[model samples]
Target: MSTLNFRRNTNNFVSGSYDKLIIIWQVYSNNQWYCQQKLNGHSNWILCLLLNNNDDLIISESEDNTIKFWIKQNQWVCQQTITYHTGIVFSLSLNDQQSKVISFSDDYQILLDRKWNVIQKIKVDKYGLRLCFINDNQFIFQSFCQEQMQIYEMDNKTKQYRRMNEITIKCGSNFDHYSFPQQYVKSKCLLVNKNGKSVNLMRKKENGDFIIEKSIEFDDQRIYGQLGQDREYLITWDNKSKEIQIRKCKER
Candidate 1:
């Protein structure tokens, strides 16, 4: 269940909670949204919401540090009390592939593979918030600490989670991390730094090093921009006037 809205596309059963009342809605064949049921269960704000991979199960994490798991046929009931965190649960990620779950909290610790029916927990240095699966066996985690970004790589080995390595992305004013799937290209990641009148395109090497590939600096600050789909067809937005400009990369 979501904070303000929760719905499933399989049965089209929608539910939302406000204050102490949880309202469930239904979508009919007429292509309209309507309320169908209301559930009054939680007494706090709903922070994180999740629907299981099959869409048959639902799990929610609240500011109260309680995780409620509910099956679709029944009302929202507490399935498990994951008292893994000392403080509030900020983020939750599940590794359904390995039958494991990961939860990051404001308490500056990482709970790894908590759903694997094993009593094991992996903790890292910084407080991890967002996570991305690099592969079926590995995961990329990011932590925000004191204006710096810390990146960690978590690998599942022998059914146990381990921290392989960690890196820190340099602190820059307009530096942004953009992820491009492997389908576009192998080992492809972009970091664009907007330097007032110039835009720099940096690519991540296979060795995990950032290298500047191209630099586009225009005399007029308004004539440069960072635009592209994956890492290809980067078009510098026309920042000066109505004139249009395009730049395409020709594979060598």
Candidate 2:
């Protein structure tokens, strides 16, 4: 599987694979999981997937340079396909209000509204492996192999987004892998970012500044993990260790 998203308030989850398939799985009361649906639409490897707050909508990006919207009717179906990107869509992020979406690709960073219409398209100097929305009007983008992550904010007057600042991060080498992703915890004001061989943990302050609290280094570049919903643990698996490790959040 390339990417997966668990639906909130439900025992179901969705996964996208490099084989160009999206599978929805449901857990039974007996604790066994079964495939509920298989969505076939993308022509290339699926890179990212996002489930909305209600779990009725799904946003997916692929190496075919297309972004697809799968909506739930009587069953899950592809309601729309966006072909605006010229390169592989690497990542997808939904804002807190679920009103906007941002996608990062090799070519451009495109923003779309709830209606799935293009709001803004930004061409960055360096293409990134991941980008995420911290809030409704703000987002962070990490350029490939760079030690700095760029911040963008929406202008209240023009209602357009512009690059506001950059946060320095740890990148031990020029090499990195795809799909580790950047995750932000709103409740804890925390960000878990994977760049090169390190996972940089940062705290976002109310003043819009970020403080790097810790950077967990690994011997290998392929690290995969997710933060627990309760903001108490981080579970990770890396090629170097070949084991699933869980780390508890410590109060500082």
Candidate 3:
């Protein structure tokens, strides 16, 4: 799987593949996941996908620089193509209302828009390290260098984005865009950023600032770690699948 995502209010999820197909899976009464729909259109590996608020639209980006919009009528079909991207698109992120979006591409530009119409664009040194909206008017942006993670807010005066604050991730040059995974603790307004060897928990303050609350390290540097949905457990595992373990988050 290249990328996968779940839709809220339903036991359904979508998985993207290097084989250039997007499969929608649903859990039945038997509690077994079964493929319900296979969407095919993108001619290259799918990098990311986003399901909108109503779950009626799915936007997918590909390495071929193609962004396809899939909508469910009586059946799934390609609704339209987002034709402006000229480079390999790496990530697709929607705003809080699912009305606006921002994307990172190999073209080294951050493009912002609503309903496929380009609203504003910001040039950067690199693309697709980790770009996400922290709220409706604010987002976090990182470059390919990954030296710093900057927070950007949409300025009301200019009606465009402006850098508000920054945090030094300082992961160094060896790690690339996909080196870290971030999980949001919505209830606590915290974001868990997990690198190979360390996990950093960032709390978003009322003033639109993010501060690191804690940083924990693990012995096995390449371990994959995830915090539980209810913030009760922290799960970790190395390459050895059998060694996977779960422990209370408080014990970390």
Candidate 4:
């Protein structure tokens, strides 16, 4: 596989092979990686890719102004192709439980079901950069310049969607768009960059509002700058000392 843009899901890794091909890799329990299947349909660069919870469905967005879905069985095959986006698809999210998937491009939200059928198309002030399912009925969205994260409600039975409200995720600071895998804890969520230097923990209230639970700044030398496994430890790697320093809490 060509080392281009690569994105990871829970069980598999989606990577672009060269500029035109995308392949799905499965990591086994013994820590070995194997190319389970290859998807060969794009004519341009693959911008983003992801796998659903079941690890059987692959969603890829490309600069070709298209989104393609593939199934992982004996062979990787194109299950459906969505060519309605006017611009390049930037991001996508899938809620397997609700059997709904949503994609975002320049200024639209393309909602599709499990069968890869277009259900609705709605316009927002800015494109929805990333999405997180709060539950079966609701999800949260963050944008490029938007200070508040938007909450969207979906009908349980009909899967109809509405922009219910907005909540302040970052008050004084500008929103970060590059980092994903936003961690959800209770009603609160943790947002961090890939480098892990800065971390923000925010909480959502019952009224669909958000507040900053904590904002932490770490040393520049710390290789791993965020909270550790159980949120009970902070790890920092020191190159000069050649040691890993861990700041952990005392056991209760």
How far residue 46's Cα lies from its native spot in candidate 3, in Å, is: 1.4
Candidate 3 residue-wise lDDT at 175: 43
Clashing pairs in 1: 222-239
Compute each candidate's TM-score over C-alphas: 0.56, 0.96, 0.83, 0.67
Taking all chains together, the TM-score of candidate 2 against the true structure is 0.96
Score residue 119 of candidate 2 by CA lDDT: 79
Once model 3 is optimally superposed onto the true structure by TM-score, how far is the C-alpha of residue 17 displaced, in angstroms?
A: 0.9
Q: How many clashes in each structure?
A: 1, 0, 0, 0
Candidate 3 off by > 4 Å: 170-173, 177-186, 194-198, 216-252
Off by over 4 Å in 4: 1-12, 26-36, 96-98, 110-114, 155-159, 171-199, 204-209, 216-252
CA shift at 2, candidate 1, in angstroms?
A: 6.5
Pick the winner on TM-score between candidates 1 and 3.
3
* CA lDDT, candidate 4, residue 193: 24
Evaluated with TM-score, which candidate comes out highest? Answer: 2
* Candidates' C-alpha lDDT: 0.50, 0.88, 0.74, 0.60
lDDT sort, best first: 2, 3, 4, 1
Q: What would the TM-score be for candidate 3 when compared with the true structure?
A: 0.83
Q: Write the per-residue lDDT of candidate 4 for residues 108-133, one digit (tens) a residue.
A: 66555446788777677775555656
lDDT of prediction 1: 0.50
In the range 8-69, model 2's lDDT, one tens digit per residue, is 87888999998999999999989999999999999998988999889999999999999999
By TM-score rank, best first, the candidates go 2, 3, 4, 1
